[model samples]
Target: MVGARFFNFILFFAGLAVAFNVKTIPLNADHYVKVLVLFWLFSTMYHHLRVLHKTGNTTVDYGISYSLSFGIFAGPLGLFIFETIYRFTVYFNKKRTGTDDPEEFSDTFYNIGAFVLTYSAAYYLYNLLRPVFELFPFGYWILIFLLVCITSLLIDLLLIIVFLLTSDIKTVREAVDFIKSRSILDMGKTAFTNGLLLLFLREGEWGALFALFFLNYLVSRSFYSKSQSIKNKIERDKFEQMAYTDFLTGANNRAFMDKRMAELDETGEYIGIVVADIDNFKHINDTYNHSVGDQVIRHFAKTLKSYINGNDNLFRSGGEEFTLFLRNRNYRQCLDLVERIRRGIEESAVEAEYGPGTASISYTSSFGLYFYRIHHKVSMEKGYIQADQLLLTSKQHGRNRITALDGSNKQGNMPVSIPKQKLVP
Candidate 1:
């Protein structure tokens, strides 16, 4: 990525140098100073309005900067000087704060080169269209202004895409998507503002030009604040999700399951709990090391996940143990789902390599299902306890069997074992 960015910088600078030599536009000292001051103010405002998203970097400053360069009639040299000062200021500020990452330097150089090339291209095109601007009606001039804005934006996007392609930050698709997702209204506003600024300059309306600059600053600041608020909310949501997710198996953790159970309890709907444990998990760890054991756990979790219906949720309660919460399901439906999951696990194998050879190891899981009607008012804790007891019974009888709480029994103490069948080839 660094190399790519460097190559882009070289290309931009070379093109810019060529444009400057082709037709040098004599810069007015007064206009250059005024434009530089306006550019500085807009750049500062742009930084203040910057939004840092979780996915990547984004700023509204580019639009404002480009607009100022084009509107002020700053020659290529003047624009280059303006960008250089801006880049230097940024670098010095970062250096003072001890936040000068290596990438910042590369980015600063890339921006400087990109801005010079972009403005030079726009200026050259605007000059070429000057004859048409005078020959055609006012409406044609508007079209020409829009063409200039679009051309500059395209150049900016091309540079950005090139930078992204070289970096590990984002894929080409993602970069294009991000650009496409940009607010069209914002782009239109920027383009309109640039055209207005150019008109003010042509008419020698100094007061209106400065007024518009400040107004744009205020608008950009508002956008920045709103974007920051949205970014914060998204980050908070991401953190919350991370907290509730099991890192090892990518399933909801026990805490999330408990929270979900509370929500389900309030719905007054029938709920079923199926607690599953890998049979002889410790033996796998002993024979093939913990890495293979972890692989087995993840495989089993994925297999169990496949059997879960839309109305059900899966959770990895802890090591070698998982739970499924079925909503709006009766005893029969829940049993059938659990039995299917059990059969799937019994037939599936996890392939792993040992020292020099690979082996496919088949495994089984024991399930304990406890179902409660809507009116039973059974707490999640109580359900868990009943399911756990049944699971213990299944393990006591044999490792590869299911023990289900018999709903017909009034005492709530009976668990029935499902007939164990041999694995089919």
Candidate 2:
């Protein structure tokens, strides 16, 4: 609180000094109103169009270029009047629109004071540097104008950074990203536009000012719209990922499995539809709790995922049941992979809460496999149904075993092969 008061005092002191100096600029009423309206429009619109956010107290004003041009055109006293009046207007605009946040009210004074000081500094700096470059080409005029803009930007940034640190750096990393997080290209854009505005303002070119102001807004809106597009795309992709992923096990969910199955006939690759079910999952849940049951599910899913490749997909189709779609694998490969995954599950132990502490609980699983090439009379959906039926057969005969069937033999009466339950030993 003392630190905040200290900052307030410094800012208000600078603002008050500028406030007491009531000297005026030489522009007529018509020209004065034109410049003031341009400043107001640029300032207000830029706030809405801003794509970046402040890092703590370090606010990046994209309107700094406009503020610089206005400050230099008017003197310290005139700039001071605009800053105080304009910021309060911003506060009221937020309130009228029902978008006023508490921070907006609290920071109003800090904003008015600090912005007044920043613009006032630009006014003096530009005046001091103007005569030094009188002999150089018009390029030096651009250089001096840029220096004023940069100096004002730095001063405003420094004040905010100091205020934030006075509150403390325990909140941020030592590797604080200042510019990269706030794009330098964005600042360059505003600075370039503001420089041109200043050149036309001094030359009394109202027609050019009107044209440039319109063009500047168009360019600014174009950049802001592009940024919003990228941001929305990223958010959309993230939501889609969340939708297709199982929350508990991080495996693909039924939704993605269904979508992948719908697209499989086009590939014409050999496909194996396998269903794996946890052995006595209800018993595990009854013996411990749902938390332990979840751990077991996750461990089982992880083991299954470890066995699959890029051409394979694992889905948590149910609480205790998982489905695997393996591509480009024959009957032998499908049988071997299912057996290995089943054995892996049977041999693994998951650490779970037991009484007062934790214990390693070993578990097992059963699998059913249906191997076939796509474009056959047996569709992917039919293969999945057949595999699911075989899965029920594996569970009924005995748990912790695999039942295998070739898609070509689905109609024939071949005896189902059940692997010896590994837990029998």
Candidate 3:
């Protein structure tokens, strides 16, 4: 941190020295026109400059491109005014959005210092290389512009490296990685375009210059649009998943079951609707506690869910109650599935703490399965009602058992339980 603050002071002093000289202001019509053009360009592109997000709270805005052009075209004094105003406006905008939380606004100081130093360096470089253009006097301007932009970019990267090395990062590797994370392609592209912009401005071709800027804006806007679209889609999917999920057991909730059932078609394919509840759940809650009862519910749901396949959906529709929807399954298939789930629940144990003592709570569940094909004349609501009634029969006959009914027959089947189940109400 000390190193970074020291570096900021040095950069600020260098920028101040360049600002005091004030040798690059406009003195003629053509020079004033050039400055006006740069101002126009900056105003148009300020809001759209590509901002690259970094790991920390730091971001690298491509505003430096404008600063480089502004400095070389308008000189040091103009560069100083432009950077100060732009960065202050950015800081206030952050304030409007409730995000103006920097350490005594050090980031603003650092940004102003770093950018001013970079732009000032570019301006001086142009001064040093002015002799080369005079020597060639035959179209060596483009080369000089390219050299200036590339050198400015290197200086920008170097300053950032110094800042990162002393910032809150833990290691040299992490500091270097911050520099590496910048887009090399973007760097090359910006430099190349700045070269073209310089040539156009130097040659005093206003029409071509504006056209090039328009093209750049169009490309940036296109990328931003596509990126926002993808981001919005991901957020929508996340919301939908959360809406349909039960928070306790990570199973589909009652809302999701209603949606899936609503979309089903009334056809010949058998649909299995199983409504199961933990046997003596209130007893468990009373014996241990609600938290322990919750564990028992989760254990039962997990055991039942393990037997469900991709074609089925299991839901925690209520406390200590779960529902399953099995598609394209016959009567025997549905019965066998219910048997496996019941046995799974019978074998599983829920671990919980009871009055400061740990205990393994063994429990069981009762299921009522209504296996049938829906008739257009009868709504599927009847299926759930029949299954619920069958659940009551299982609880009445005994717990730890399944009572199934095949409802597509001429004569409706009464309660049918697994013969091997022992009575344990």
For model 1, name the residue pairs that clash: 1-166
Q: What is the TM-score of each candidate against the true structure?
A: 0.76, 0.84, 0.77
Report the candidate with higher lDDT, 2 versus 3: 2
Worst 10 residues of 1 by lDDT: 52-61
- For every model shown, the clashing-pair count is 1, 0, 0
lDDT of 1 at 187: 57
Model 1, 268-359: lDDT tens per residue?
66677888999999999998898788889999899988977787899998799999888776677777777888888888898877668877
Query: What does each candidate score in C-alpha RMSD?
Result: 5.4, 4.0, 5.3
Q: Where does the lowest 10-residue lDDT sum fall in candidate 2? A: 171-180
Summarize candidate 2's per-residue lDDT along 1-425 as a digit string, tens digits: 45665666577677867756746755676777777877777677666675545545444345434666777787666667667667778788888999665556545677767766777777787778777766678855566557654664565465445546455333344325442244455556656766787889989888898788777778878978898999999999999999999999999899998888889867777888999888999999998889889988998999999999998899998888999998877877888888888877777799877779997999888888888777757677887888898898898887788887776445754526566543211
Q: Model 2: how far is 375 from its true place, Å? A: 5.3
Relative to the true structure, candidate 3 reaches a TM of 0.77
**Stretch of 10 with least lDDT, candidate 3:** 416-425
The parts of candidate 3 lying over 4 Å away from their true place are: 1-13, 18-22, 25-65, 68-78, 89-106, 119-177, 265-269, 351-358, 419-425
Residue-level lDDT of model 3, residues 121-240, one tens digit each, is 777877787677766654355554565546555665755665565564667776666556656566566566666776776787878877877777777778877878898999999999
What RMSD does model 1 have? Answer: 5.4
